[model samples]
Target: MIDKKTYNEIGVHIPSILLPKEGIDMQKWSVVACDQYTSEPEYWEEVEKKVGDNPSTLHLIFPEIYLEHGNADERIKRINNEMKRYINEGILVSQKPCMLLVDRSTPHTKSRKGLILAVDLEKYDYSAGSQTLIRATEGTVIERLPPRVKIRENAILELPHVMLLIDDPDKTVIEPLAGKLDSFEKVYDFELMMNGGHIRGYRIDDGETLKGILKAIEALADPEVFKSKYKVGDDKGVLLFAVGDGNHSLASAKVHWENVKKSLSEAEVEDHPARFALVEVVNVHDDGIVFEPIHRVLFNIEPESVLNALQDFFGSSCCSLEKFDSLESVNKRLSELKREEAVHSFGFVTDRSFGVFTVQNLKHNLEVATLQGFLDYYLGKQKEAKVDYIHGEDVVTKLGSKPGNIGFYLPSMEKHDLFKTVILDGVLPRKTFSMGEAEEKRFYLECRKIVKD
Candidate 1:
């Protein structure tokens, strides 16, 4: 198969946990990643009631909503206890080591296929100057790591909702595995609760298929080829294995491992399950994948304050476009303005008015780029201007239209440019692209116990 020996040499194992036949309601069992839609508690609450009393992943995990109010310590204790209980109860059946073929489909979309595998953590580096084989596509918010570390420190299992992307535009790696999915044994097939839709998985044990995947990954890792593909002067000593989603979760694993490494031996470190976190790898050019726009929300900022700030930032050149009653209307105007390349239209839904801010650029870069720089500086001075990245424009309008709220609807990043920008420039603006809308995210169904102590 793969250089399994190389992985072993690096002290990592690809242990897998599969769903039982009788308990195969994966849709309910597999919830979206804990970190997604953190602002929406009702969504999590609905999942709890639907998953109640069943052998669901919800039972074994703590929703991030409850993490606030000084309850995190208690949550971690309960999570650890439940993990131990699940393993002791023999509820989790271990599967033979192999790659997993995943296909997820929602009501409005077709199947989204992916391959699940473990990457060597030692090959990854998240630091700004890191030239590690595995790299982050955006700036990592360092402050988000501590709370995640607290959860992972005693986590008995690790389930991945994070997917990594490879720059292979051709059908080189994942496409071949998709063809063999039907030949392999089906591991899970069911509907996901909360309109998340149907999800099915297959195990890939064929030696030839596994070898192909390995060869493709190895080719991507070749320093000469990678540099030539990106047209960089030097290799930068890094491979563009991007964290498409779940950047914080990977960061969490990194943080905990560093802290625990001080007390472990070389052998112990190699054998630690934490050394290999499960992740799905997809080709960047997959027809099913799309980079959706993530918007910004500033809460507790008055509508008048927003107008004042806009007036101050752009002076008399700023003109307020007609108020949009619906997101569709706002989007139409934004599209119309984007064609001009000389003006920028911002959709803003405030208490005083639902309107667009048409600003003729007096200075700076792209309109969004210029606006972000000023927002960063403004929020730096005023701590109450809390910023959030929203997945849809509708969400932007819905959340921003609330009292004491303001929102900035940004355009989507062109998917084709993502790889080139990262390879040539080293990094892109943070939160530049989202794999898909919120529901398209990886679900948390499988789990690997990282710390058995």
Candidate 2:
């Protein structure tokens, strides 16, 4: 067990990770994050066929795609039952208290490395302008939490796809651990399903090694170090960790913890399982990590009217629209803008035509911020209009080309600016950037009990 002193020092707890017993098909057992493939039900259907009664994380998670399909209450009931059965039937066995060193490889990215550990929720604050050591990189949508809270509130086990980022530009924290992995025991090594690339985990159980990791993380959180790195004033709060992905999931955990803590005694609050959430923390400077933009696709809207509304809102002086004959020309223009160092320009594709919209004067720093603001207002006025945040240019072309559909492709934000921007300007707009494509997301492999026996 992790003592209070150690937990306080590192803002992490070594969890008793639950893994499937031997002879289980690890390939079928792991699945991508629940939040991914929300627009495509067929992806989940394919996953169902592959798992086929085998013990899998698919049974434990309620995919968002199915959230609106009805029977949500029944689905959550089945999830909780599966968790209990997994424990009772010895399908999942707990290991010694340790951190899991993860190595992930995908087709589009280099081998990304991370350490899976439980972070103290107390150190994290998702509210705007929070001064905590852990902060959200993007704004948290409270309305999106009820469905997630329902799934997590009564669950016996928690499997996290939440990825946290630490800005250790000098590579002090997670990088050094990779060198000493020879001493750690191997956990699970297998290829993930759904074209999600390979993954391997090692257990770090040595007390001294765990302490070393904590010390490194603490150094990154040091006030002077943070100030020097970001060139900020002494009054600025040190942001040691940032939410890289799954901001909503982490927020839900926080909300549930708040509700749970209210009913617990002071003693229970000290080491309550609900007080910490399991996450894989990765270094921001890791070469394997790539920041991709989450583009916007609008459905059931008059494309011409939407374009005119954008011009009306921003005015002709600030907003200019240039039409293109095909997707190639639009992409070519966007590629040129990248070399020209132009910002606040977005490419749009529709059934009628393709074009690029350039805004000379902007209220927000990122193009997505400016575009999303207008969309929120426009969609509010048009009750029939709907928008989905999507990844991949190909998806935008395919879906946005359908009649009455339009997609706006926004450029990605620089990885280096993420920490400093959040520290100075508060949280960014939601759905700002994706860490990688959907397939590259963290798959559920490890589990921990959140409810006390």
Candidate 3:
């Protein structure tokens, strides 16, 4: 409900929990975004133990682990209460109108630096083939929007762990603002607890630097140049921003705003804060950003069952090899398989040992694009094919080695071809390339109120 003029003029005056320059004990002060590690409860448990009673960000935010619990409603109530408490108690302070400069370092030795500012929702759109100012790099999942809507509905404040990506590999937008850092005041600088690494922030009050960023964004948004950059036709609109992560969160905002718009007029509709979602936009070409492959683990299915499934999916040409006893052997075999050969491999595991299965001539809709869709179609018919998307090969091996489980490893998406592929062809399949691994994920820190006055 926030308009561009007001959004740019006053911006959203949301409060944030500021860390002192003396340096925060980051291990306790910084926590992973609530949505990460949803399938891994142990990680969250460790975080809880590490952040115990430390006035941590953990207390201020709700972990998605509690999403299914009975106390979820109560926890959300507490979150809203805490937002008011943090503001009323002066635990969070307000800054003069400006963009917040942030430097984030992950546990994986990668660092991302950017500015936190409110983007006008009016300029954003998420429809397919949308030339809207904002777009999704991968297809947005419509099914995941409801729970997020419920989470943000009554909240007094919204905290973002979402990172948006722009193709500014030349360090054009964010780097120039660093020179003016001395002109702005320092807001937060601390170490994130539990190996999240370090984070620092400065508030930019100078109109000149902010205007420069606006100009850069304007250039990227320019219709002709934008189309040429993507090599699309002149009639096509420019798709400048992409939802690198937190697609659901942004979709939830869109859903909530559409629902709220029924009773309000055009003018009144622009006043609500729910219109804009908070996100950190990083350059896709930023050296710190890496695209990792998301591997799959099928749980509670026996090794023989996996073999049988593969054989059934690929027909009589499928073959099983029990000699692939080591992880390296399986990797070497899988890497050598050609995409055009219609052959695929899987690592099967049981409580006692691990083995491998190689399938050939699997009937797939589009060999490269619909791997998950085909799996979903086949798995939907079977009772034991429970799949989990995982981040690292180590996790894949560990999970697949568990009782009644198997793992399928996929190749990583080529980063250079992502935008072109999406522009030429439609969006890629969901659960595609991960921006970074689990710990390197965007953390919840900056916030913007979607409701406007």
lDDT per model vs. reference? 0.73, 0.89, 0.67
lDDT tens digits, residue span 1-453, model 2: 335585685577778889999988999999999988877789999999999999999999998899888899999999999999999999999998889899999988769999999998998899998988778999898889999988899998899999999998889878888888788888889989998999989999888888788878878887888888889997788898899998999999999899899999999998899898999999989999999999989999989999999999888887789999898898888887766444578999999889999887668988889998899889889999988888888889888888999999988999999998998999999999999988999999899999887
**Candidate 3's residue-wise lDDT over 150-252, tens digit each?**
7777776777776777777567888776677677787777777556677778887665666667667666666777676777887665666777777667777
Provide C-alpha RMSD values for all models, in order: 2.7, 1.5, 4.0
How well is each residue in 303-395 modelled by candidate 1, as lDDT tens digits? 777667776766765545467677678778888878876676667777555667787754543445556766777788778777777777778
- Scored by lDDT, the top model is 2
How high is the lDDT of residue 333 in model 2?
A: 88
Q: Using TM-score, give the best candidate's number.
A: 2
> Which pairs clash in model 2?
none
> Can you give the lDDT of residue 357 in candidate 1?
77
Query: Candidate 2 or 3, higher TM-score?
Result: 2
Candidate 3 lDDT at 152 equals 76
Candidates sorted on lDDT, descending: 2, 1, 3
TM-score of candidate 3 relative to the true fold = 0.86
